[model samples]
Target: MRKARGCFIFFMIIIVIAAVIIFYFIGSNDRKIASDDSVKINYSEELASYKDNGIDYLFLGIDERENENKFEGRTDTMIIMHIGNNGKNALISIPRDTRVELEGHGINKINAAYVYGGVNMVVDEIYELTDIKIDKVMLANFSAFIKLVDALGGVTITVAEPLHDDKSGSDFDPGTHNFTGEQALAFSRCRATAKGDFDRMDRQKYLLAELFRQKANFSIIPQIPDILKILNEDTKSNFKTFDYIKVAFKMMINRDDFILLTLPGESATIDNVSYVIVDPDEAKIFLNENLG
Candidate 1:
């Protein structure tokens, strides 16, 4: 009996070691694509202070559930992340269904930029629409997204309604809910409620903030190897290694400094299609007032 117990203990130790090795390899791989077209880039040209202490990056969640390789999908979620010099951060979520003026496509749903021209095009359209310069971009499709949330040991969220979706195999009750990767995806995709995309945006921001909050635990640091592997495989970012470390430290140090804001716009329809139209004059004022 003593010999058998020793063998079992050794087997468990081996299994644990193997899991660690696997995650390390998974987290270490990363490939970056360089862009040659300068005209398409807009965020880099700014003042020294803005370039140094203050930086802005756009996080784009694309619904490439259909065909990610082909780059065919709508921009399911668009968020602008801004970090101030004092380590203060602000995240503004843009609703997908908001109607706006497309750069070359005239007027259409803002999310349609992905279907028309992929990430670069979508980024350009946003620059034209908002006049806010974006310094970096992070893009993720659905699968990578699920992996990211799950890697974080799932995020805690408030599920307002009993959500049931057959396709994604998601069903959750209303309350403070703990969500796995699949559940988070469903929560982000939900548009059936009374507020529709508006409500969904709030949930996305809330869940993301919660995840950031949870990441403050020192325990997550060791998991970096595994997380980086998943991120390399499933996520795309223009962030350098220092940028990642800086952001992580900032989140840890000043999690409460995160401010939330939505775009200043109203719903309007032109012809037959509905749009979230930003009154240009009013928008400039709002941007200067809030950001400046």
Candidate 2:
């Protein structure tokens, strides 16, 4: 009995030491990511007021190209990830061409808010449009998206039909396949289908859902450092490293509960400019019903 007790205590000590070492590395990585100069964030009073729900996040995909100013580009994609308290989570896509009135910039595409006032402006516009309060925001450029996808060992997506678009450099035949970073970007950017931008938004939601599902698994633990490095270099967000870690755990545990939604709207040509017209009341109702 004495020898068995001694062995048990020795194993417990080893387990405790291993846990401490793991936590130390996680904390170090978090601090390194937070210390990056480019990841600085300034919170506005309005944004602060909307912090009722701690799990809501707004993710923006910027269209900036290589050598261009990343901070000034129009948002190519906008998504709200709402993690409900009841174990229900949702990925809601807002079309970039959705029509909205900017405070000082008159009526324009919703994507323009990013150019006028960055992520804060986009948050305000979304609130104005859907009455949904965003708790945090993440902005990633094309490079970030590509690198992050590749880092995750790519995502699997199914193309319903053959899609060919020269503008976005996307050409995929109908089938299911694992896509590289470049192919994923092209798939998300291609809007040459019958529904145009709406189809693109659907693809974005699907791709993101798949990415989250893959990333939440235990197999990706060895790649966390590379993933964090990519995020630190190419992404800007109000999320701390711990916040990301918690989100990943939540996603892994509740992967089956995740659902995808797109803001309801119709395409219209107004004054020769194309736009997606969404009714505010209807949008709120739709979200309220589905988000829970």
Candidate 3:
């Protein structure tokens, strides 16, 4: 019996070691891509260069379940996370359905930029639409986002009201809810309320703040390997390694410093297509007021 027990213990140790090796390779933590302009190549490159102070970073969460390897997909969520040198941070959430005029494609939903020309076109359209100089971009798809959240054990959020959206698979009551990775993803996607996208924008900001708060915990160190791997495979960032680390640290420390705002626009249906007509000048004013 003693001999058998010893063999079983040795086998379990070997299995654990093997699993660690597999996850390490799968995560590709050391391998990271650095893009100067866009996530992909473009003939006409018009993009903002990386800056030091008051950097504006675009966080684009895309619906990339279709293409796993290419990092190309229609953006499901667009957030402008601005960090100023004065230790202040602001976040502006742009609805995916917001209408914009891409250079090649006249007028379409903002999310369509990725479908038309990948990240290059999408970044260009944002610059045109908001007139905001984006210093960096962080791109991730739904699957990778969920995986990172799950690897962190999950996040706790307070739901102000009961929400149930069959479209997004979100169902939760008013309370402090401990959401699994999948639940968190669904909550971020829910837009079936009377306010529709408006309510979703609020949820996204709330979730972002909550995630940052959760990340400040030192307990998350053990999960870093897995999370980094997921980020390497599922996300793309134009920021340098130091910049990424800097912003991450800032986010953790200044979660409450986030000034969450959404672009002001009225909804209109043109040619039976719903759209949000955003005036570039107005958006610029709003940013200056909130960010300046």
Give RMSD to native, each candidate: 5.6, 4.9, 6.0
- lDDT of the candidates, in the order given: 0.69, 0.81, 0.77
Model 3 residue 13 distance off true place after TM-score fit, in angstroms: 18
TM-score of each model, paired residue for residue: 0.78, 0.85, 0.83
* Sliding window of 10 residues with minimal summed lDDT for model 3: 27-36
What order do candidates take by TM-score, descending? 2, 3, 1
lDDT of 2 at 97: 93
lDDT, residue 79, candidate 1:
90
**How well is each residue in 141-242 modelled by candidate 2, as lDDT tens digits?**
998888998989998999997889999989999999899999999999999999999899999988888787777787776566667777766777767767
The parts of candidate 3 lying over 4 Å away from their true place are: 1-53, 66-70
Taking all chains together, the TM-score of candidate 3 against the true structure is: 0.83
- Model 3: per-residue lDDT, tens digit, 29-94? 324443334554342344434233477888888787767654676788999898887666878888
State which candidate has the highest TM-score: 2
Clashing pairs in 1: 26-229, 27-229, 98-276, 99-275, 99-276
Clashes of each: 5, 0, 0
Candidate 1, residues 1-292, lDDT tens digits: the string is 9999999898777667656754554344222434323113433333212433367778888677666472346778899877876645777787676676666787678788767765666666666555666677777778887887887788888787876666545577888888888888888777666766677787778777788887766767546555777766666666655566677787787776788767777776778877777665666566556666
